[model samples]
Target: MSLFSAAVAGFGTGLSLIAAIGAQNAFVLRQGIQRRHVGAVVAVCVLSDAALILAGTAGMGALVETAPWALTAARIGGAVFLAAYAALALRRSLRPAALTVDASAAGPGGRSAGRGPLAAAVLTCLALTWLNPHVYLDTVVLLGSVAATHGDGGRWRFAAGAVAASVVWFVAIGYGARVLRGLFARPVAWRVLDAVVAAVMLALAASLVAGIPG
Candidate 1:
């Protein structure tokens, strides 16, 4: 196949994996709506995906696919993290604080006017990216395998296409979600959103547990 065709195929494949409503997308939406270091978060996501895609393109995906134990460990760690975040969301739902709600509010943890909050936000972004086993499974193994079908030069183009998809997705979710800022402006709406987040997190955790090594 031609490089252009391969790139298009890769782009479509990447979107098929990421466009779904999953943990990573949810966190990015929340951060975007909260208007907290959105650019940095988006950058982290795009760059992380790029690295993972490149690794896959370079054939790391095959090596990873051969190791089920590593994915099992990641599943356990990710489930624990998601459960903790779910509890936090539950707490937020039950005890609705006086949210700033305006265009300008503190971080989700409610800290402002310091580097601490920004640093914390960055850490959360990294955790969300690295801890999830699905990211590796989809981007690294699955996408990498797909790219290999395109041959060497075609595979690189395919990887570029996949990276482009990541850029588009993160930019859109990290910025487009701001459109819902007014809807989430009320404490009631915030509570509802947190409840939804909690549910999603729990569901993801359950799935992770189900996938654990028996």
Candidate 2:
């Protein structure tokens, strides 16, 4: 296949993989709604996926595929991280907020009080992306398999296309949701969203612990 064709194929695969509602997407959407450090969140997600795609193109996917220990470690770490994140989300959902007597005084409170620290948001994104074995299978193994069909030069083009898709999608989801930021500003809305996020994290953690394939 030509490099252009390989890149187009990779882009399609990336969109198909990332369009699903998974742990990572849920986290990003939640952070976006809460008006957190959205740029940092998008950057971490895109860069992490790019790294994995490059690794897969470079043949690192084969090494990971052969390493059961690596997969096991990732599963355990992901479970722990998701569980902790669920707890944090639940806590945020339940926390009391200072009530404002004047309607004008009310603004984005709750999780939207202030943008989270950039470094912390980036670390959180990294943990969510890297700790999950599913990420490897999706970005590395599956995508790599597709790239491999195109031969050496085409593989790099494929990886670049995949990386581009990730960057575009994350930026859209992370910032585009700002259009509805007002709707999510309500405490009840925040609680509902956080609860949903907590459920997703817990479910993902349970699935990992059960050795269910991503």
Candidate 3:
């Protein structure tokens, strides 16, 4: 296939994988709606994905497949984090009055009132991105192997396309969430969002614990 065809294939694949409703996307949506460190959060996600995509394109996916222990460790850690985050979401859902688009609603940490909201957002975004084992499966193992199908030059084009998809998807969600601020201004809206977040997080955690590929 030509380089352009390879790029298009990679772009489509990357978008499909990243567009899934998971912990990372959910967190980004929340941050976007709240208008809390939106740029930072999006940056962390896109950059992390780029790094992983590069690694996968470089053939690190094969190495990852050889190490069952690494995936097991990631699954355990991701499950724990997701579960804890779900609890937080559940708590927020129960307290509708506390739910607001204002940054002061939860403070910078997102859990409680403290300093360094940027730091908290960055850390949470990183965890949600890196801790998930599926990320490795998609960006590293899957995307890498697929890229290899193209010729040597075509593979680099494919990787570029994949990286571009990540950039586009993240920027759109992170920035586009602002359009929903009017709706989210209502406390009930926050309750619903948090409830949904809770469900998604718990489901993902359960899947991870169950050793599911998705």
Q: Compare the candidates by lDDT and give the number of the best one.
A: 3
Q: TM-score of model 3 relative to the true fold?
A: 0.93
Models, CA RMSD each: 2.2, 3.8, 2.9
Candidate 1 lDDT over 92-198, as tens digits, reads 78775534355444545675422336788789889878999999999999999999999989999999999999999999999998899889878888788888989
| Candidate 3 lDDT score relative to the true structure | 0.90
| Candidate 2 backbone collisions, by pair | none
- TM-score for each candidate, following the candidate numbering: 0.93, 0.88, 0.93
Residue-level lDDT for 159 in candidate 3: 93
Candidate 2 Cα misplacement greater than 4 A, ranges: 96-112, 212-214
**Per-residue lDDT of 87-140 in model 3, one digit per residue for the tens?**
999998897756778665564335643223688889999999999999999999
**Model 1: per-residue Cα lDDT at residue 189:** 85
What lDDT would each prediction earn against the true structure? 0.88, 0.80, 0.90
RMSD of 1: 2.2
> How far does residue 67 in candidate 2 sit from its true spot (Å)?
0.6
Model 1 stretches with alpha carbons more than 4 Å out: 103-116
**How close to the true structure is residue 75 of candidate 1, measured as C-alpha lDDT?**
98
